[model samples]
Target: MALTATGMGSGLDITNIVKVLVDAEKTPKEAMFNKTEDSIKAKVSAMGTLKSALSTFQDAVKKLQTGDALNQRKISVSSDSFLSATADKTAQAGSYGIKVEQLAVNHKIAGTNVTDPTLPVGEGSLAFDINGESFSVDIAATDSLAAIAKKVNEASDNVGVTATVITSDAGSRLVFSSNKTGEDNQINLTATDTSGTGLTDMFGTGNTTTLQDAKNAVLYIDNQKVTSQTNEVKNAITGVTLNLTDADVAKTTTVKIEQDNDAVKTNVQAFVDAYNSLVTAIDKMSSYDKDKKTAAALQGDSMIRSIESQLRSVASGRITAADGSSIALYDIGIKTDRYGKMSIDDTKLTKALSEEMPNIEALFSTPGQGLANRFYDLADSYVKSRGLIADRETSYTNQQNRLDDQREAFSLKMDQLTARLTKQFNAMDLVVGQLNQQSSGLVDRLNSLPGAVKKS
Candidate 1:
């Protein structure tokens, strides 16, 4: 870049003049551009904040809309040592005397001592029939006691029984244990061998001993005998399941099912808390500061107003309950204050839930028109694609882009202005230099012509 010639003849600062002029043309518009850009950015950030708050509220709304929070049930036990009980929504509120008789045991059997586990025991097949299902493991004369057990355990078609070899000073023996517990599930093994089989002699010679007997779990409910193949007993009572851990023939306990109050209260309170939180967020983004006389980023935003109004209408409207009865949020103690914030009256809510929980559940999960359903729908409108909040954010982003374009154009304009000013000022300086030279020549010519007496 060529340097600008300052006022050589006219003593003017040409560069400084160009700069001041260019700044004069640029300052006001630049300030406006930056101010508009900042405002748009602020609005974009505010929209994101509102969208996030809407999502949080929707998370709480989902539980109620799906009836998970409404239908939650808890289990209680009378004597945990002997038995435990779990109840679900289908369980009727009632009590029953429970007496545990005997716990089911798995069938176990063992063969007589084998001189050596590593020596071959048999040469054909050891077929096991357990719980009406049968599977077999082929044996070879060279198959050892350990090998037979391994073959049985590793057979892909084998069902319930497991084979193992037990070695002790008493001698080495092959043991079989049944996976299922029932009289019918007793371990029954059939041996077919070619070579003088060691297994047939150990078992066919009446050397196999029954280690434990297969028996069903027996319990007496109100003195009515009940038997199960497993410890867990279901549907002995409607929606109630009994889990037996220990059995005592002489001891008695009780199974009780009742409505859970604390869980219902907690769920209602969560909904209220979520609503209040959204209210706080809305207020913050749309509030005006009196001391500073400044409005917030989203103040007077029509979208925010519309969202709050729609949700408020849903909350205040009545829901058509299952029994053809209409119920409102306030009927269950969910009230909205003048500020449009939700609050709960604990006493009123507890009474409503305790007296009519079915109706309350219906109020929040009545298919399409419940409070949770309506709120989720409304929030979705604002948070989904092309939603009000999303559209607003897009608008602000577009504004930011346009501002950038204008700023670039303005920058080019300032550069042009500076160039023009510098050119004009330099031209003026040249003219002044020529004029000073012409004036000096005239004085010199006059001094030489007439008896130009020196000023001295």
Candidate 2:
């Protein structure tokens, strides 16, 4: 609104003066608003970190609640070349002797070779019976050996038979094999011709060459006989699956299923690590730095203080055991230091695990009074949707939005004030310029009179 040559008329830096005055009014208010915004944002970030730490702690708690963690078993085989075994929670801890007598084999039959594989055999339907399930493939007069094999393989309802053409020094022989390994799963084929005798001439009604004989796997478990139609023998032993790789009648492999101490120890250590990390995060957020004269973003926050208090309470509390005794973490070799960090003693932990494992599990996994269950419930209240953390974040976001609106309104007011000040200064400069001109003219006129030029 003011003239671009602001100070040219009055010889005064009016534009700089207006800028200095406006800055003096605007800077302090804007700084206060920015500081409030930063503090709110930092609090929101700290809440997010708290939520993440709680989630990690909850995950660690979940591991101790499952039966698999408490009853884990590790299987060992003396000779892995013959077979390997896996044991589950239901398996009893014992050693068993296993002898592999024979492995199951699939039945395979090959038809006699022909002069030309591309030559059409005949228009017929080839039928097969596999494990009491019957299926057929329609053969056309123009269908070659390869085409017939493809048709047989493309049959969706085919139970356990696969057909292929094998090329040897003799010729390409169409072979059909049973996918299942058992005497009951033999592949028997019959051909019903319509036009020519090519089907009977090639494979002959009863002259199929046997490539492999179907047989059952025979084994001895602790000198007891066991037979299976498949190499994978399951249910022969409770919670154990024996996968036979080879047959060695003279050798016996010992399979030992025992409680997996290392696995349990690893899980315990993981829980300890998770707990320590969560405690460390909470401590940092809630602490004050006296040397720097600054407080953490979450310092003096009631919700954060409550969370830390509950977690520490759970860690220090005890649980009632099945023997009517109270068991604490320290009894199981898990101890907390002066700084509230937890650690495990390897030797002590192993001994406790061997002797008081059930009691230790009860401390963390007992139905409703378990330490893990309590921690899980507490953390869930904060990290869940529409929970404490979510509500706090929403409040902070509202504050930021209000700050943004205030900033916009403040800026508009400052612009209006600046424009008004500029216009006022320009009008004053114009008036001052006119006054100076009139004063100069009066001096000149007086000098034109007599004795006006004598004064120095």
Candidate 3:
């Protein structure tokens, strides 16, 4: 006979007993590996958060490290319509009387009018002289007025020349304009007709009218004369760029360049904000709640502790001031409280900026001893490739990989144990069924020999 189902002949739940035994052997080991994997993943995630916070702080530090941050200038013009201006750090703080006499213009010319745009002009080559560069386009007899204009625009060697068609009461005419400004950058056109197809007659040398003349911009600054080929004038005053928009001989606009104290204050505030955010992030990661019996992911981590310590030191360190007195962040109104939180005193900060602006800037950005430089260097070491954060993440990843291998091995072992247990229990059930059969045969033989009446 075929083997009975598991536990059927023995009247015992052999399958369930095997399951209980297998679970007892496998559950605790799997739980341990899973817990390790979770801990490693949390560490990797915490490292990512730390790197991001450090990068934000680094950006703010870089802004303070530049020379422009201290020497920034603001420009104001009396009339934007007359002229607009911008000044850089090199510009001196002063006022200048600016009078724009004339704005630079480009040369424009229109061809003689014709009845229709499609009408053929002639069959010849149209030569152009633009800014001393010479190029030409061949004209066919079948080429219309518009067609000739298209050919002129499509010329490969044409420099500073644009062609268009204009229709007025005088009829259809081709127009040409110079892309450059100033009198020296004029557009001159001449046509040659070999087949005498009237192409030269339509757009020849005499068939054009000067619509606008090219001229340079002329201006006066504090009684000093200035001329520019274009409206945009650079270096008219050192580190100042002037844009002359309109001409007004009788009106004058005053241009002023001055130190931008407000901008500097704003930059300082941004730095403070970024610094505070990073501090808060670090604090949260390293905090502990005694009452709740809970700790943060990076609590007690040596690397994180070291990073926080270095950052705080840089913030509070003293640097040699211009007047030989040591200065630090507190002198500039950036102060930390007992709990390591930062707060800015606006009144004190503004006063310090107004009185000792240079000293304040120098205190935070003075070469190797500068706060920003030290902070940036520290952050870079942690965030850059092969840095502290990267190495920590690598360690966690390796741990996770090992845990994965252990889990795979445990699963394989559990599977083999289950198969072996099932086979052993099935063999025990078969033997028990054979013993029951033998016992039943012996009982029937004893009943038959005792001459006992058949009790029904």
Candidate 4:
């Protein structure tokens, strides 16, 4: 007694047939929606991969290119003292002490005025004017003379100042002296009340006096001033060279600090590889296939378009050279077609890199600046654009949610339809049973007296 619109048998019910047909259509729609969701998910994953690759490529490029595009720079170190850059590469110029023997050493002598043995004059104070900076310190009386001396030695920023304790038949007194032997090296030392209550009791204060007088020594490197007692000059080179001599007077010598070639080669190779990898990715994204559609995720993506455009613009931009002519990507052999896939014109690139490298570098990176400063900003912007990969992921996520909601709603509706069909089918089953009973009764009444053959 199944009800259906199109009956396979006479007993088929119409309502059941309609419900079955509708549910059948819903099943495929749900599957199709699921397939679409999966597709979107795949696209999101691909976008993330691409974005990650771009970020890595940008970092690599920045590392390789950031610097004075010039591979080598020569630094000269000279000292007035008899010192020179060691011929042996294993030696460090800093290890050699120039004019150290003549340098005045500060000696400490503990005053008899130490009223407290626990607070013995170990903690002392010394103030000195160094290169316009006022340096002041208070030492604990309990601190050993050696400990106090260590503190003074550690304070190298002060002008040629050093400290030590002198033990003699007279007793012990802390002495502050200038290591440099010169009028310029003369230092004015004044012990404060907090340092010890006995300044006039031990060392005279009130007048400008040399704490300890030693012949001021002079040192020159490559005719440049090297050292003085109160002299402010430390290294002739701005942190680039060191004076390695022991003489107190001026001496002429040379020290060579050369560019690290190995580092330069490593950076260059890294740049080439990163650029090539990025180019390969771009090629894959833009190329077409005979059996498949263009990478749909990249299709109509503004980020990809912008990246390609900027990269092309950078590649084509001109760089002004010292000779006044302009430099281009073509000059460097980094040529790209309208699609933006790149190939190294090896010979051209080599010639430009070797012969007119300054121009090539200026085009990609500004002179005297890191490589990133030149073209990395664009690459950075392209890679870090808003609503690019994140937007794609968000869109996919939204669609997935929407589809899931729809599927849930559809399932509920289908369940309701099935429930209604089941109820109607049950009702029809009872009706069929009643119809059979009525037909049986009519046949029984007709056959009561006369013989009747029933159609089976």
- The TM-score that candidate 1 achieves is 0.83
Q: Taking the tens digit of each residue's C-alpha lDDT, what string does model 3 give over 259-301?
A: 7988988888888889889989988887898999988888899
lDDT of 3 at 146: 76
Reference-based TM-score, model 3: 0.84
Minimum summed lDDT over a 10-residue window in model 4 is located at 86-95
Instruction: Give the deviation of candidate 1 from the true structure as CA RMSD.
Output: 4.0
Q: List the candidates' TM-scores in order.
A: 0.83, 0.84, 0.84, 0.63
Residue-wise C-alpha lDDT for candidate 1, range 1-456, written one tens digit per residue? 222466886788888888888888788998999889888888888899999999999999988987757765676667888998887777778778888999888899998886777877767777888877999888888988888889988999888888889998988998999988878789888877667766687665377889999989999998999998888889877888888899998988877777887888898889999999999999999999999999999999898888878878888889887889889989988889999888888888888877778888888988889889989988888898888777787888788888899999989988888888888888888888878888999989998986778787
lDDT of 4 by residue, 1-456 (tens): 443333322356656675777669787988898788877776676677677767877787675463453343344445555444322222223322333324423322233323232334434576765334457566766665556667777875665666666666654555566554455444555566655454334444642334455543355444444444423334444334333345444333455565433443445556656766776676565456658754554555676677666666665667665677876656666666654555665666556555654565455556533344555665655456563566666777898898889888888888787777766665666677667767889978997755677668
What do the candidate models score in CA lDDT, each in turn?
0.85, 0.87, 0.85, 0.56
Which residue pairs come into collision in candidate 2?
Answer: none
Q: lDDT by residue for model 2 over 146-226, one digit each (tens)?
A: 999999999988887889998888987899999899778888888878888777766666657899999999999999999
Better of 3 and 4 by TM-score: 3
CA lDDT of 359 in candidate 3?
82
Which candidate ranks first by lDDT, i.e. highest? 2
Error of 3 at 180 (Å): 2.5
lDDT of 4 at 288: 61
